[model samples]
Target: MARVSQAHLDARRRQILDGARRCFTRNGFHATSMQDVFKETGLSSGAVYRYFRGKNELIRAVAEEAFDRMRLAFESAGREAPLRPLDEVIDGVLTRALEEQARRAGTDRPGAFAELILQVWSETLRDESLAATLHALYDRMRVMWVVVVRTYQDAGHLRADVPADHVVRVLMALIQGFIVQRAVFKDVGGELSSGLRALLSPEADPHYRG
Candidate 1:
C-alpha cells in the first residue's frame, strides 16, 4: 500500500472532526451517533472509526476544539502583557471568537456558540469525565487571565487593591454574560468594547477627547 502523507492524514482527521462538529451542532451531543458522523463525512465506517474510536471520542475532540479557541484567546492576551489595555485585549478575544463562531455557523443566526455551549454543558452534567476535562481547560484559562491582570496591576493600569484572581473572575463573568446575551437576544445594542472598558474602570469612557 502507498504511504499516506502526514498532511493528508491531518487533513483527513480534521475533515472527520469538522463533519462531527456539524452533526453535533445540528443534533446535540447525546443525540448524535457514530452513524451520524459517518453520514456527515460521507466516508466509510472504517475511515471515521480509524480517526475516532467512537462517538464519545468524537464529542471530546469537538468539545476540546471549542474550548481551545477560548483558551488561546486568553493566552494571547497574557503574552501581550501591559502593552494592551485589559478591556481591549479581552474585547479582541471576544470579537475574534464571535467572528470565528459565526463563520463556522455558516448561517446568519446569532449565538451559535452560545447554543452549542449549552448543549455541551448539558452533556457535561451527564458525563463526569467530560466535566473534568472542561474544568481543567477552564482552570488553565483562569490562571492565564490572572497573570495578565496582575501584570497590568503592576503597571498601574489596573487597581492593585483588588485580588488578581477576583478581577479575572469578574472579567470572565462579563464575557460569559456577553456570550449568553448575544447568543440569546438578537439585538444587543451598544458598543461591547466601550461597555467592557467601562466595566474595567469608570475612566474607560471612549468619548473623551482632550
Candidate 2:
C-alpha cells in the first residue's frame, strides 16, 4: 500500500471536522450521531472512527477548534501598538464570528455559528468533560480580556478605578449576550459598538426624572 503523506492525513482530518461542524450546527450536539457524521463526510464508519472515538470526542475537537480561532483573533488584536478601541475590537470580533459561522454552515444566513455555540452550551450542562474544556478555554480568553481592559484603562478610555477583572466580566457578558441574541433572535438591531458606547458614556440624560 502507498504510504499517505502527513498533509493528506491532515486534510482528511479537517474534512471530518468540517462535516461534524455542519452536522452539529444543523442538528445540534445531542441529535447528531457518528453515523450522521459519516454520512455528512461521505466517509466510512472506520475512517471517521480513526479520527474520533465517538461523537463526544468529535464535539470536543470541533469546540476546541472554534475556541482556538477566537483565541488567535484576540491575540492578533492585542498585538496592535496602541490597542484598538473597545468598540472596534468588539465589532471586529462579531463580524469575524458571523463570517466564520456562514462559512461553516455553507450559507450566508446569520447565526449558524451562534446556534452551534448554543448547542455546545446546552451540552456542557450535562457533560462534565465538555464543561471543563469550555471553562479552561474561557479562563484563557478572560486573561486576554484583562490585558485589553488594562490597556483601555491606561489610555483613559475606560475608568481606571474599576477592577480590570470586573471590567473583563462585563466585556465577556456583552459578547455572550450578543451570541445569545444572535442565536435566538437572529436580528439584533443596532451595532454592538453603539450600544457599548452608550453604556460607557459618562453624561446622563437630562430627561430622566429619577
Tens digits of per-residue lDDT for model 1, 1-210: 999999999999988988887777676777888888888889999998888898888888788788888798779767988897777888787777766765564544446666676677777878888899999988999988888888988887777777999988888778777777776785663467888777667245364222
- What TM-score do all the candidates reach, one by one? 0.85, 0.91
Q: Using TM-score, give the best candidate's number.
A: 2
Candidate 2 TM-score to native: 0.91
lDDT of 2 by residue, 1-210 (tens): 999999999999999999998888888887888889999999999998998999999998898888778777876776661456677777676768677766876767668887777788887988899999999999998898788778877776777777999988998888888988888999974568898877654344443332
Q: Which stretches of candidate 2 lie over 4 Å from their true place?
A: 81-83, 202-210
What does the lDDT read for residue 85 in candidate 2? 64
Model 1 accuracy (lDDT, Cα): 0.78
* Residue clash pairs of candidate 2: none
Worst window of 10 by summed lDDT in candidate 2:
201-210
Work out candidate 2's RMSD over C-alphas.
3.5
Query: lDDT per prediction?
Result: 0.78, 0.81
